[model samples]
Target: MNAEAAIDLLKQVVLFALYVTSPFIVLMLLIGLLTSLAQSVTSIQEQTLTFGPKILGLALLLIVLAPWLLRALTEFASSCITRMAIVAG
Candidate 1:
């Protein structure tokens, strides 16, 4: 592929990765921050307290967002495949 085409592909790949991962990562970050704040307020220093909530939140988030995430990835993959076919043709 030409330089411009390669750059575009890289940009798409980065965007797709961010789109797929941003939700879970952001959720975890927010949960961690909130949990820290709660712990600070309540003076509970249990290490496991944060883990359970974060995991459960992320699981729930994944369940809720799975369909949209899957569809986006599928579409991106399909488009990439189609582009590859056109390039090869």
Candidate 2:
């Protein structure tokens, strides 16, 4: 593929990655921030305080969103494969 096409595909790949991971990422950030705030308020500055809640949030998020995430990734992959065939042929 030409440079422009390659760049376009790269952009798409990055955007797709960000879209797919946004929920988990946002959840983790939110949980961490809240944990920090709570720790600050309570003066309990334990380094490990954020991990448990973030992990639990991630697990719950994955459990809830796994199906949709998988579907989106499958569709994107299928689309890329079909486009690849078209470009090749």
Candidate 3:
């Protein structure tokens, strides 16, 4: 493929990755902020406290978003495959 086509594919891949990861990432950020706030209020400065909630929240987010993430990835993959076929043929 030409440089422009390769760059376009790379951009699509990055965007798809960001879309798939956004939920987990945002959840983690929110969880971390809440955990920090809780720690500050309770004076419980435990490292695990921060990690545990974020991990659980991310897990829950993954469970909730799995179907949508799979659909998005599948669509991206299908589009890539179709484009590849067109380019090759």
The candidate that wins on lDDT is 1
Give the per-residue lDDT digits (tens) of candidate 2, residues 1-89.
55665666778889999998888888988999999999999999999989999989899989999899889999999988876654554
Query: What is each predicted model's overall lDDT from 0 to 1?
Result: 0.88, 0.86, 0.81
Writing each residue's lDDT as its tens digit, candidate 3 over 1-89 gives: 46666677778889888978887788888888888999999999989888878777778878888898889888999999876754554
lDDT of 1 by residue, 16-69 (tens): 899899989999999999999999999999999999999999899989998998
Worst lDDT 10-window in candidate 2 = 80-89
lDDT of 3: 0.81
Clash number for each model: 0, 0, 0
Query: Worst lDDT window (10 residues) for model 3?
Result: 80-89
TM per candidate? 0.88, 0.90, 0.87
Candidate 1, overall lDDT? 0.88
Q: Rank the candidates by lDDT, best first.
A: 1, 2, 3
